[model samples]
Target: MCLISFFSLIFFSFFLLVMGISYLFNDFVLFIEWEVISLNSLSVVMTFLFDWMSLIFMSFVLLISSLVIFYSREYMLGDININRFILLVLMFVLSMMLLIISPNLISILLGWDGLGLVSYCLVVYFQNTKSYSAGMLTALSNRIGDVALLLAITWMLNYGSWNYIFYLEAMKFDYEMELIGGLVVLAGMTKSAQIPFSSWLPAAMAAPTPVSALVHSSTLVTAGVYLLIRFHVLLVDTFIGQLMLLVSGLTMFMAGLGANFEFDLKKIIALSTLSQLGLMMSILSMGYWKLAFFHLLTHALFKALLFMCAGAIIHNMNNSQDIRTMGGLSFQMPLTVSCLNVANLALCGMPFLAGFYSKDLILEVVSLSYLNMFSFFLYFFSTGLTVCYSFRLVYYSITGDLNCSSLHVLNDEGWIMLKGMLGLLFMSIIGGSMLNWLIFSTPNMVCLPFYLKLLTLSVCLLGGFMGYLVSDVSLYFFNISYVNYNMSSFFGSMWFMPFISTYGVIFYPLSLGMSMTKSFDQGWSEYFGGQMLYYSLKKYSLFNQIVQNNSLKIYLLMFVLWIIILLWLVFIM
Candidate 1:
């Protein structure tokens, strides 16, 4: 299985290169249809749509999955279920491929549900309390999206077909189509972990690092953005589109704040993923679908690389994920540190890196658009917080005093892991520029005021300063201070979203149910049925007892009266 996975990796890399080059000269598309059920005016058909977007996305998914499989070989070396792990990853990749090629809602559901179920399996693979809890949260949260998609499929019945692509262009003005658009947005939000559904992304760190890298980066999270991109044409000038813009912007801001307060290395990265997803959704909500797609592809490259680097660090650190327990590892693990720095800088939109091409373009386009003050604040503030948390992470993990009591013998020596990371490292450096040239064909023209032009750089610099001040060794002296306690707690806990999702949503409902049971089932029903029947029977027995006691004297008098009455009646007759 390992050998097969390795060969598949090479084959996919070569194939992606060939197809990417071929796409530049001539675009190709394929459509295959099969009739399923047909009545007078109703039809249900299975259809596949393969275009440049699908091909590019599928190639990247394959590339990342292949590398993840190779990396897992070393990461899961002694595991008893290594074959199951590889098979699950393969299944995940296949499901994503199915989602990419399908234009029909029903077909998309097949892939969507496949991803949700397989991801649950992967999350719970460790067979521990943490994994089990995380898996349930992940699965159930995604189930909401599955339900939304099912509703969307049902609503499409109004149009007499299940193929959404055919109607996306024509249904822009149809009022009934708003329901589908709204449902799609709701479904996308759950899958992408936006705001109310955002808790699952961080909790999902319970999965193996490779699964985190693969699922969070490209397959699971990106699925929502891809779906939105597919339906972008139908969302223009719609109320749901504007609502999505607001929600996504807030999500971006929220995730960035959460990252700054996070300590776990993997969870911090996960929060960063949430923040970037928000950015993509924000852009898509603004009707720049192509820009969102461009960022999605670029983000997948660096984020997958970032997660792999974190996995290497965690492996070397004896599975300790807390950043506070780590320091000054750059001297021992140079390659891993190098990759980490590159990926982080790329995430911050550093120039010439893969992230810069998409991220910078996104910011420029956002600036040019006419937006309200709230969105503007969110866009820039989130950008600043990204750099803030990133530098703080670097300070804790890459530089500072060696905080470990006893250092384990560590080095950047895992050949398979390094090889896997190496594949994405170069792409993280050049992928953005290559994709920009291929997708845009020409650079976007921007004419902004001087202050606006310098806004991102200035905010980034300010955030870097704040990050340094917070991480400085002297800040430890102020530990006794209760300053900003509530604020810090809020940010650290992701605004208590996990609590709200679990306790707030579940606890109150369950509490209400218990109260109802006590009031109706145990209280009212018992009183009205059992107690009332018992009391009525007791009264009847008392009446019978009184009648028996008085019956002897009353019987004799009644016999005399009865005889007299009979005599009078006979005379009258």
Candidate 2:
């Protein structure tokens, strides 16, 4: 029954595409509107609509969602409440449908937050300590970023109409849109897990394989990229957008390091997601917005397939996540083994794979254009690192000795999951072959790189091969902490140290302290309220009592306190 509903969803989305396309290419303006309308309304959403960019985003989101739902039936099946899972799965798709189809920023936020909410529910559906904690981390980190976005919206709303295009038009940086845009970039960075909020992504491995496969690998992380692309006009200031590029590039480097060392199967994919999104931001920052979306499209295919394959391995092994614990199932699961190897190679940008076309395109754009010297070097290094880790992920999972003395994964998930990803595998293996026709041959106002094409190809191929050849050696090196001690030297781009440390010092201590302050805060909360000097906060649970469901009284009191502080600060200024 779940299988039937899932296929029905896919067929219905395709039916929507055919119906809309049958009449869309009528007139130029009509064609534009129809493109947006078809994508947003793919799930039968009548009120949802946008322009060409949104259409591109919507089409991929719909495709990934449908594929994940189809996989869920066989991937999880009897182990879960199939009916509820399917319903929630539909809710996930519906939320994304609402998010990308809407033409207004307000509608976009509703859709964005809704996507985050449903994803949390899905990630933590098992209600285990790990999943629950991961969900909470995701929620908390994203909510803080969401607040920044809300602040941007409020700032923008103080100026003009409540339409997305109004803000998008204003993105050209009129009189006051720059500050608001800068704020939006901050929110976008956090939502996209550029760096500070990126930790939650790896922890999200607690989610079932398909959810991790779809949300992190494709839809959710891409939301930030979409936001940046949507608001590119206001990004004229390098000083402002510079932050976006620096953060994204460095995050890719950081996460790729962890990927280089990580032993957990799912975390490897999580790290790849970080770098992939980082590359997306890199492209978007350089004004190649369409290419970023195009990269996103191809990434969704291969990454989803990769994660689903990892899930199949986990299910087969009865929930073993450590790659070191398994080996030599290739004979038993040759199809899966073959698929996994191709996905890894594609992920590392091997020839003709999905990643090759998209990844190489971004590289071409960066190297041939005004992409900064620092970004250029970091970009190449990061891709090399990506290939190394991609090799490790495949190596550790398939070639080692089996340690399944107590493990119990399903023999095979059969076709429900396999069918969902077969297309992705094929695409990852052959996507680059069509790049000349689909991408390279396109006529655009922007100039194409015509000279030194061979140098460009050499850089990409060399970076990838260097990564693959010594992955085993890199693995051993990472284990010895040689790299961690000299991380700053290796990455060498600390452009935001002053600001990141000023406000974001919490990450360092938290990463090392293991919630030391959390324990301290819990221990001191009673004393804080019990003291007569503490007239503001009530004496109760610090997080829950004061934060989650705080009353109108508390809000107003906090407002007054803020006003008083503002008055004092004004006098000092």
Candidate 3:
């Protein structure tokens, strides 16, 4: 396993270097197509696109996968099925790679379904009821996107080819192509967990922390963003684009708000990932595809680092994930705590960090754009909420007094895990600056008022202070959570999105099914169609049999009626 990790890391690094050079000098797109079958001017072709974007993205995917695998060596050491776990992780990464390189919708769907299927397997790896339920939610939520992708592929059939890249520009304004574009956006939204589809992301934390690091950071969640970036031509200046902007903005705000209220260590990080994904989607919707992509890469670096540190902490703490039970870990595990702090601050967009470069630029671009008031508020407020949650996490997990029992021992003893985290820690600190230089040929020129320029920093500081104060025990008489229990629960529960995504979505359909079963299968159709007909036929058949028998009672009744009629006629005369 270690050998695999070492070789994979070296291979990814080499390719990343090669691709970076290619991106700088050549910047060319290479398309490979082989016709599998053709009939009547229609061709079924296997298509792969190797451009700077796809190559670089694939490199990052492999790079992160290698590190996660390295980290998992120590993390999953006690599990008897370690080999199977690693195999599943590799499969997940391969699916992501297939997704990144494919230009054809049919091929993309192959990779897309692979991701959904493997993710379900990984999510349910623990074989517990919680894992099973979470896995179901995760799989079902993603199936929506899979269905959308299928619909988009079917729409692409109208274009006479499954290669969507050929029709991206045409899809922008063509009335007939808008539906395909809309389906593409829907696909991206569900895969990326935007707005109403977001409930699965946090629930996915039931998986092993290594899976969380890989899935939340680079592979699964970001697939949607990457898809949107590819389809940006269709989204720009369109109704679907505007709707994406609104939904993504709401998602950002909702995730940030939920993160502040969450106590689970992995869950808080998961929510933070959702928030960043929202930022990426929002920028993509605004036609800043490059900026969104920039953020995506930088975010992957730090988030992976963050989750690795989280995984280490959880491993040492006997698998306790509740932040409330942790405190004063800075004394024992200085290295892990430092890495965690760096990742956290980077997430908060501290100056000179990876997150700062892309995030600040995104904010500046958003401010410069002619966006509505709602979007502007969501952007800044979500930024602040990000800081709030990070500080809250830091305080509870690192600074507060040890809240667990005295028998517990916590330390950064696992050198293997530490090595894995250290790789990402360095990248988290310097990655944004490096990527900034490589991605943007010319720096964007944005001149804004001093106060407007200061807003991002101001919000960060203000959010930090608020997080500290809100978390301080002295600030409240009762538990702060109890003061606004209902509201806190609402925010913490992600606006009841889990219920909406799982129960709410299925409730009406299932209810209607039951109603139909009762009314038709059991009631009206049962009686009126088959059973009622049988009863009617039986009654008529009995009456006919009696008539055929020519019963004496029936003959006597007929004679009596005839006599009565004759007597009446005689009386009248």
Candidate 4:
């Protein structure tokens, strides 16, 4: 019950941090707590693992968490337990705060695991079946990542130096470091939902709009990308770094494949986030560390805004999330609809949006990565896929035949959420000009002209317009009763979602059946054919059964016989 508020938490964390920064700026041996783990704190105040990087990360953490808390007050005004919510928010922010400054392996793991575990609570805090499963799935996926990171730390200590700073420093050029680097990338892959890890993000749509806003859309999932940002120098020199590029490229395409077909309000955003993260990973693969972090910085702004706006829609529409059920709300709830659409257009990377600033820079970095020719293709293709899904999301959710009988003219959202969201949205629209292109983008790289970028938008726009023509054609062909979705029935999620509902549904049982069959075959083979001689030993002698099954006795006798022969050979021969 005794919990520090986010404001107080920020004040304390920052107070320690500012002192550390001042110490470092003054050319002193300044230190700060870079890691705290397993109830063990060096507790030396701000003199453990301090650095400018940690300081920068601290600043963004304060800003984002403050914004989320601000948004939470309005979004959850009448929440039955606002205090508990605030407590969770503080813990979430604190854990991240600890993570950014963690100086040791154990401390990093503490924050990493805590961040993942707390996220599940946030995702499922609403106590609904959908969000519960979604949170569980995300948590489980994160557990896989946690195991990899833990193993990596253990392996690093087993093989090299046990110290955290040493391993981090050694990894920069150690030829033997790829083993841990690969494991860390694997951990990143699962957390960021690259390729196979992509499904959990879409499933996480079961979360409340605000939780989704904070977790999947904003800061939580980006933790993986942030890890990449932290490890860029080490990874770029290893084979695993190249693997990151491929993984990022494939995830970008995968998101487009998933989101283009998804019509759910949150799922589209979820998939779009995945796709955008792929963009960040792709940039990180090229070793644009600061640019990747900047992309992450701006992405948090726009993604959080979109998720909050989506929350407003869900709260108003009696929790209906299907985009097809939300057409033309601009006429009824103009402010909310406009906010959501702006978020959508921003995600689509329309000019002037926060997404535009970040995405253009990411693509530009990819272009300038003199790493090789293939990298250019990967960047170009990733950009094309990015635009594809972004446009699809914007058009489908706002310009369709939306008729949800459950919907009411709900304007329940309070000032805190609106203020937080508007501040972010305004930045999403105009943050591009304020950014440093040279830091992230390639030096003197040729980018698409304004007309060409516009042309790309027009092509995507035409595709979006076609989507309008084809939205919910099922209404014309069949009754709602006939189209009633039985997600739990034989064909789950319409036999889509390649892994969970489709492959797992069929292949998991098939795998069990195959195992049973293998067991049966082994038993039969031993009894009748492969071991028939054992069963019918000695032509039906009474002692045969006992001898057949008694390997210990048989081996003992053989050993004695062999010893006798050896003694005989020495003595007689």
Each model's total of backbone clashes: 0, 8, 0, 17
* lDDT score, candidate 3, position 181: 80
* Candidate 3 Cα misplacement greater than 4 A, ranges: 37-42, 473-478, 506-573
Q: Which candidate is the best by TM-score?
A: 3
TM-score, candidate 1, is 0.87
Question: Mind giving the per-residue lDDT tens digits that candidate 2 earns over 1-573?
Answer: 665765676676565544433333331112123223344535222244544445445555666677777788777777658778777777777777776666556667787898789878988988888778678777767887688778877877676544555466645646567777777788788778887677777767788787888787667777777777777766545566777788788888887766766668888888888888998887788777778877877787788888988888877877778887777667556778788888887777776777877777677667678667788778887887787677666666666556567644435447777777786677666655543344444543434556545544565566556555545555565533354556633332223332353235435645656665555554465456455335444444464566668588888988999999999999999
RMSD of each: 6.6, 12.8, 5.4, 10.0
Q: 1-573 in candidate 1: lDDT tens per residue?
A: 976986886697568656765764587767899888999976767898867788788888888888889999999997988998999998998899899889999999999999999999999998999898788888878888999999999999888778888888776777778788788888989999998999999989999999999999999999999999999975567778888889899899999988987789999999999999999999998899999999999999999999999999999989999998888889989999999999999999998999988888888888899889899889889988999899999999999766888758779999999999999999899999998988887778889999988888888889888777777743576641247788889878888999988764456766898999999888899789887899999999997887688777777877999999999999999
Ranked candidates (TM-score, high to low): 3, 1, 2, 4
lDDT of 3 by residue, 162-275 (tens): 888888778866887888888888888888999899988988998999999999999999999999899888778888889999999999999999898888999999999999
Score each candidate by Cα lDDT. Answer: 0.88, 0.70, 0.89, 0.66
Return the TM-score for each candidate structure.
0.87, 0.77, 0.89, 0.73
State candidate 3's TM-score.
0.89
| Model 2, runs deviating above 4 Å | 16-47, 400-413, 429-573
After superposition, the stretches of candidate 4 with alpha carbons farther than 4 Å from their true spots are 1-30, 33-52, 158-169, 370-378, 400-402, 410-413, 435-573
Tell me model 2's lDDT, rounded to 2 decimals.
Answer: 0.70
